[model samples]
Target: MKLQSTLVFSNELPPVKKLGEEILLIYDQILAQKSPSFGKWAKGISLKYPVKAGEHLKDIEQFPRHIKAITKLTEQTSVKKLTVVVVGGGSVGDFGGFVASILKRGVRLINIPSTWLAAIDSAHGGKTALNVGGAKNQIGTFYPADQIIMVRTVLMAQPEARAFEGFGELIKISLIEGGKLWSSLAKEKQINSKTLWKYLEAAVHAKYKVVAKDPHEKKGIRHVLNLGHTIGHVLESHYELPHGIAINYGLNFALRFSVQKKVMKPAEASRLFGEPVMGFLLSPLRDDLISVKSSDLAEYRRLLLSDKKKTKAATLRFVFVKKPGKTVIQEVTVDDLLIELCRQREEELHG
Candidate 1:
C-alpha cells in the first residue's frame, strides 16, 4: 500500500526496543504508524517513507495569531493528499488539535504525544480546544484522533519538573483505573520513554475505554476521568502554573473538599494522595485569577457555572472520589460551592 491515515493495533506486537537502542526499531515501533508523506507518525505506517520534523511553538496567549500562522502554513505546504496534522501533546496538542478541528471544516488528526502529560492524558481522545480570553479550554470540539501515537523516547528531553507534571496525570489515572500502573512508575529511578510507556499505555487504555463507552463525555461514566481536573483546570488558569503541576495542586484541594463533604474518608484520600499532602501543595499561585481576593470564591464559582458540561438547570457536576478506582459526579449549588471554596482557602491560609 502507498499510504493512508488509519488507527492501528498489533496483537502480535514485537518486544519493545530499548531507549538508546536501534533507531529503526524505534521508528518501526512508534513513528512508522503516523503520516508518511510528512514522515509523520500516523501517516507513516508503511516502509520506504522519508521523515521531516516541524517546529510547533506557542505561548498561552498566542491563540489567534497562532491559528493564522497555521492557516498560512497549510496554504504554503499545499500537498493535496494531506488529510491531517499530528500534534504532539502538551499545550501544542490542545492548540494544534483545536486549529485542525476547524480548518477546512476539519482535517484528520493523529496525536503524537511527547510530554508525560500528553502521553497519559491529552493524546488520544481528540477533544481539541483553545483558550478564549482568560478562561482555560474555553473553546473545544468533540473530534477524536484517527490514531493516537505514543513513544517514551520523545519524552526523554523533558526536564524533571515536566516529568513530575506528567506524574500528576499518572496519579489521576491510577485513581480512576487502578494503582498497579502507578506503583511501577514510582519504583523507577528515572523516567524515560522505555520505562514510562507502561504508565502511558495504562492511561491511554483507560481513556480509550471510557471514550468507547461515552464518546462525547455526555454520559456520567466519562466524567470520572475528570476526577482531579475540576479544580486542576481552574488552578491552571488562575496560577499560570504548568498544567501538570497545577493539576497536582487541584487534586489536593479537590480531595480535601471531598473529605470535608464526607464523600470520601480521610485515610483513603491519604492513600491515593501521599501523606503530608498539605506540604506538597503548589505554592505562590501568582496569576490574576489565582491571586487571593475578596471574591476569589465568587470568581471560581462563576467560572464553574460557565462550564458547557453543566446541566440545563445550571447545576454544576463535580467529580469526587468515592474510593480508589472509583468516582462520582455530584451536582451542587453555586452558593454551596462558593462556601466550600472559601472554607478551603481559609484553611490553607491558616495552616
Candidate 2:
C-alpha cells in the first residue's frame, strides 16, 4: 500500500498529457456537466466509463454486471499498459478503485476526488469499499492509488451546504491530532470552502499520521479513526442523512458520552465545548434522536449490529476522547447504547 504520489491542481484540468499512454477513464457524469472543462477533457477520451455517483454505485449485487461490462470495454486495450483514472467523489472513487484493483489483477489507479468531503477525507485513504443489504462498507479492499489528484477547481465548485457537511471529518482529525491543527481550527471564524482549503493539507497529514500507524486497522490504533463513526453510521442509515452530516451529530454524541462515562471530567468537557469551532458541530442541526420512539431501539440495535467494525457480539469498541489528541476505547453493549440514547435525548430536550 505505497501511496506514491499526490498532485494538486488549482483552477486547472489534471495534466492528462503526463499520464500513462493507455488510459481508461471512470468519471461521474454529473460532474462533467458542472465543470464543462471536465466534459471537454472527457471528449478526448475514446473509451470512458461515466457513472452516476451515489451509494447505489457500490451495490455488490449489481457489481458483477458492472465488472462484466467494464471487462468487455477493456478487452481491446492492453491490460498491462492500461491506467484506470477514477474521477468523482467517494462513491465513484470506491467503485472505480475497486475495479482497478481487481480488473486485470490490478491496473494503475489515479484518483481525482471532486467534493470537499472526498478531497479532505475519502480520496487519500485508499480504502475502496462497497455496500451490501443497504449497510455501508460491507465489502472493501486496501488498494492505494498510484496517484491521487486534488483539483481545487472541482472542490471549490461544491455547494456551500457541503462545506458544513465536510467539516465533520476535518474536526474529527483535528481533535485527534490536536496541537497546531486544533489550535488553528478551534479559533476559526467561519467554516467554508476557503477555510476547508486552508486546513486541507494539515488535516490530510494528520490523518496520514494516524493511518500510517495502522494501515490495515489490525492494530487498535486505527480505531481512533472511528471516534464518531459507530453511532454515526447507524444514524446515517436510520435517518437517511448524508454520511458527513450524520457524523457531526455523532461526534457530539461521543463527546457527551465520554463525560457520562467519567472518561473526561465534566469541567474538562465543558472547557472543550467552550471553543468557538465547537459550534460548527453543534449548531444549525436539529437532534433527530429526540424524535425516536422508545420502540425504535430494536431497529437502531439492528443497524449497529450491521456495522462491519463491531469487534464482539452485541458490543462495539467505541472511541471516547479523554481530551483533544488523547482517546481511549471502551467496549459498550447494545443495551448501554440504547440507554445512553434515551439519556441524551432527555438531556438535550431539558437543557
* Model 1 ranges with Cα > 4 A deviation: 1-80, 98-108, 130-140, 182-198, 270-293, 306-314, 345-351
Best by lDDT: 2
Looking at candidate 2, the ten consecutive residues that score lowest on lDDT are 283-292
- For 162-239, candidate 2 gives per-residue lDDT tens digits of 888899999988988989999889999798988988898888888888877878778878789888888888788777
How many pairs of residues collide in model 1?
11
In the range 145-172, model 1's lDDT, one tens digit per residue, is 6555554445554555576777677667
Q: TM-score for candidate 1, please give it.
A: 0.66
Which ten-residue region of model 1 has the weakest summed lDDT?
18-27
Per-model TM-score on C-alpha atoms: 0.66, 0.92
